[model samples]
Target chain A: MPQPLRYLQIFATFARNSLIRDMTFRANFLIEFISSLSWVFMNLGFYILIFHYTPSLGRDTGWGKYEFFVFTGTALMINSLAGMLFMTNADNFGELIRRGGLDFVLVKPVDTQFLVSLQRVDWSSSGNFLVGLGLAVYSLRCLGVWPSPVTIVLYVFYLLCGVVILYSLMFLLAATAVWLGRNETLFDFWFYIVSFGRYPMEIYEGRFGRPFRWFFTFIIPVLVAINVPSRFLVQSIRPQSLEEWLLPLYTIAATVIVFAVCRAVFQLALHSYRSASS
Target chain B: MAAIEIRGLSKTYRVTRKKEGLVATLRALFRPEYEYVHAVRSIDLTIESGEFVAFLGPNGAGKTTTLKLLSGIITPTSGEARVLGHIPWRRENAYRRRFALVMGQKNQLWWDLPAAESFHLHQQIYGIPPDQFTRVRDELTEMLGVRQLLHRPVRELSLGERMKMELVAALLHSPQVLFLDEPTIGLDVVAQYTIQQFLREYQARTGTTVILTSHYMKDVVVLCRRVVVIFDGQIIYDGSLTNLVDHLGDYKIITIRFSDGQVPTDLSRFGKIILREPPRVRLRVARNEATEVIRAVLARYIAEDVSVEDPPLEELIAALFASARNSRLSQERGNSAVPEDTTHSANH
Candidate 1:
């Protein structure tokens, strides 16, 4: 069989096995699914309350209640997809290091990165993804300006790019477990970093926020992950500046660079892995 | 070509040196003293294909570390090794595909899922054909008597059952080289014997090069013909298992069962009386004198049964480790004047 086909087959098997594993603990799975959905719903409620008093999220930013909702929906989908695919696996990386479960992974014929990154899928996160999709469609209908076919395709492509960026970031943090022994603090860092991506990049444009905007945009590239994809779906927003026009290309470039860097770091970390003594 | 070849392969780890007590803990929290641990040091070894070699050593003797290095689970700090003409530390897919490593303590299978699910995942990962995968999986499960347990959640299975499933997972790829690290670490005698029998049969049929590190002497004795004893991160002895006895075991144990409580008096005249029950007595005699001692005992007492056996491999190995430690201690004492290097090196 061809290599790519074999990897796809492996990933399919992994997804199926993860579903089986999740189904084995039926009540826990349901509770997790409900818990994730409740979080998304509560966040949406908070936004709804805020929108009641304001015409737009920011002054002269053209992000109306529904527009910002679209952005929020994009963020939700991207985060949910990332959570579904890599969250559990990345969270378990430290445990794998501590318990030496990685030794078997390293010995497999499959790519170590592929095996470690996609071994387990958090199916519960799919609930949040469906909710995010509902919010996006509802917001689009409320706005009464549906995106073109080309725009939708571009939006989906950029949404996938966003997911990849998030995966790469989480993976890079997880890879540190090899050196740090226990990197439970990485989730704290992740929450802090991903929080910035939840809001519009325009909100971080003042004196204090400019530096953060610049840092997250160019250095970490988290801001552009959701911002550019949201721009594609929110038809009212048009790219007027050269930087804005290049944002989509920049997100694509960042996704590729960040993913490549993460893969390289993961491999380097594997070289350093001392696999807890048997 | 040899299945495995290593030249001066060494692995040194920089581990934190923690002192006890509040002051020391605080000092360590700030200053953090570290020391180097030579896990595997300056060792060279070669094993041909289809050879079942047992790596015997006490804890921290680098047996598992050596296996990890050979299987590409970890890189060596210095030197080089090639398993099947590929540098193991390079971790090429081709090299990885042809080799398998089974650790008894770790579960590669998903805990909540059945062993069959994990087996299917392995088939996809290794790209084993459907027919070949089924054949191999069925054959392994049958031989290990785990066919019924395949559908049970791995967490629900007993340790022995889980270990059998782990073996099946490791062997699904039909690897040409197998590395087993303490594969019978926590198992009952029956389970251990079953695995030992399976491994013996599998290695015979597959012609796979097998390197196993096991503390269980029974595993080593039953499954391996060649034994390599490691001590202090060094290869202390490497030869056939039988020769290991002939070379280090100087004594033989003789057991005589006297007829109807007619036990001999003054048994010390014959040899060192190890066991002195009423009708049955066991004596430890020099290997050269074992036959004469047994003959004399038999002639003197109406022996219903007589048996002569070499000293247990466990005792011989323990003695080997003690002697090696003593020599190492003396060598360290002789070199006490040398300055110790406290500088921490980069962990590999």
Candidate 2:
């Protein structure tokens, strides 16, 4: 079989395994679904609180677009990325590598990087995904921005870019297990970064913060998940000169670059994994 | 052509020599001197396809390091190895897909889920087609008698059950090459035999190339046709089990049953006595003098019954290691015949 076909086969197999994994614990899925739904409602209340204190983001106020502001951007971004993959899935790979559980992947005839990254998925997070998309649609109706077919396509493309960026960044961090030996703290550090993704990048300002934001821009570009989709909703928004071609193109380009770098690092790391003796 | 070829395979590990403590760890973190432990010295090996080979060694003998190099788990520091005509460390997906490595101490199964769930996940990871997947699963689980154990969570299974389940998981994809490290560790005798039987049958059916490392002699003796003995990061012996026993077991065991209340004569000059009780005298006699020794003992003691037999493989292995270590000690001490402690393992 062609190599590309094999990659797709591996991907499909991982995805199918994820489905079986979720079905394996039918009861846990229900409990987790309820827990995720409750978290979504709690976040929506937090979203409403953000606009309540700032009239600039309140309905009918001068900059009145809280519905568009909150859902199409911050709240929607959180929910969408939450379901793309679990934070634990990234952490588990590192632990697996340290524990020698990853030898199974090394001996198999599949891309270790692909198998490691996509092998496991937390199905419970699909609850967060569904709720987030529902809220995004409801808020879009409230803003009277139903999205043209073109905007919808762009939304998916950017969303995919955002997901890829996050996955690649986390994978690269997990790949550090080969060198660092224990990537537990690093895995937690990435999830901590994900928490920061819940807000717009404009909130923080520091000379050092620019590099921090650069991570979301040049490195992972979670900014694309929010800023681009928000542009489709805000009527007054305009693509500043180069931002038009540059942002999406950079998002796509960055995804490819991060994935390529990850693949290279992963191969280098595999060379270093002397199997555990104890 | 060699299906697997390793030339001058060497591995060195950077290990901290200090004991673990807060003070020691902190100081070591900043300016620690890492001792380069040569886990595997320059070693050469060529294994043909479909060979059931045992890679045996005492603790830290570099047998596992060699397997790691062969399976692409680790790169040799200053050597080259090829498995199925590919550089292992490159880890081409094609290469990985064709082989499976099972570490006895570590598990590949999901902890909280049934073993079947992990198997399904494995199927997807290997991209085993549905029909082949079903056939392999049914046939392997059937042969291994793990059909009843499949639905239970791996954490809930006994160690033996878990080991059996691990084999099913490893072989479910039908890997042409298998690297098994102490696969029968922590298993009951029956479970070990069950696994050995499955491995023999699997090898016979698929012609899979196997490289197994174990402290257990039965696993190597029963499953492997060829044995490679490694000591101190070198392949000292590479041949067959019968040859191993024959070459090292050149002495026969003499157990003489004599009449009660009779002390046996000082027969130390004749041979090395291994055992002496009230009415039993065991001697280690050369193969050529066994008949004469037995006649001499029987005539002298009016023995009830005398038996002569070959030593156990374990005993021969122990003697081989003891003599090897003794020779090395003599060399190190400049032929002083150093009176070193031999009450314990000479290799130790």
TM-score of each: 0.96, 0.86
Task: Assess the local accuracy of residue B212 in candidate 2 as a C-alpha lDDT between 0 and 100.
Answer: 94
Q: Compared with the true structure, what per-residue lDDT tens digits does model 1 show for residues B140-169? A: 999999999999989999999999999999
Residues A1-278, candidate 2, lDDT per residue (tens digit)? 67787677666655666676678778987898788778777867876786677755433322344544433343455444644454556677777677777776777666666667766666667666766677667667776766778877877776666666667667777888888888788866776766656554444447976777777776565565555545455532554456555766666777788778878887777777755664
RMSD of each: 2.4, 4.9
DockQ of each: 0.85, 0.54
Over A3-106, each residue of candidate 1 has an lDDT whose tens digit, in order, gives 89888888888888888888888999999999889988899999999989999977878799999999988899999999999999999899989999898888
lDDT string, candidate 2, B133-227, tens digits: 88989898899888888888888999988988888888888887889989998888999999999999999999999999988889988999899
Would candidate 2 be rated incorrect, acceptable, medium or high by CAPRI criteria?
medium
For model 2, what share of native contacts is present? 0.80
| Model 1, runs deviating above 4 Å | A235-237, B260-265, B340-348
- Candidate 1 recovers a fraction of native contacts equal to 0.91
Q: Candidate 1's error at A147, in angstroms?
A: 1.0
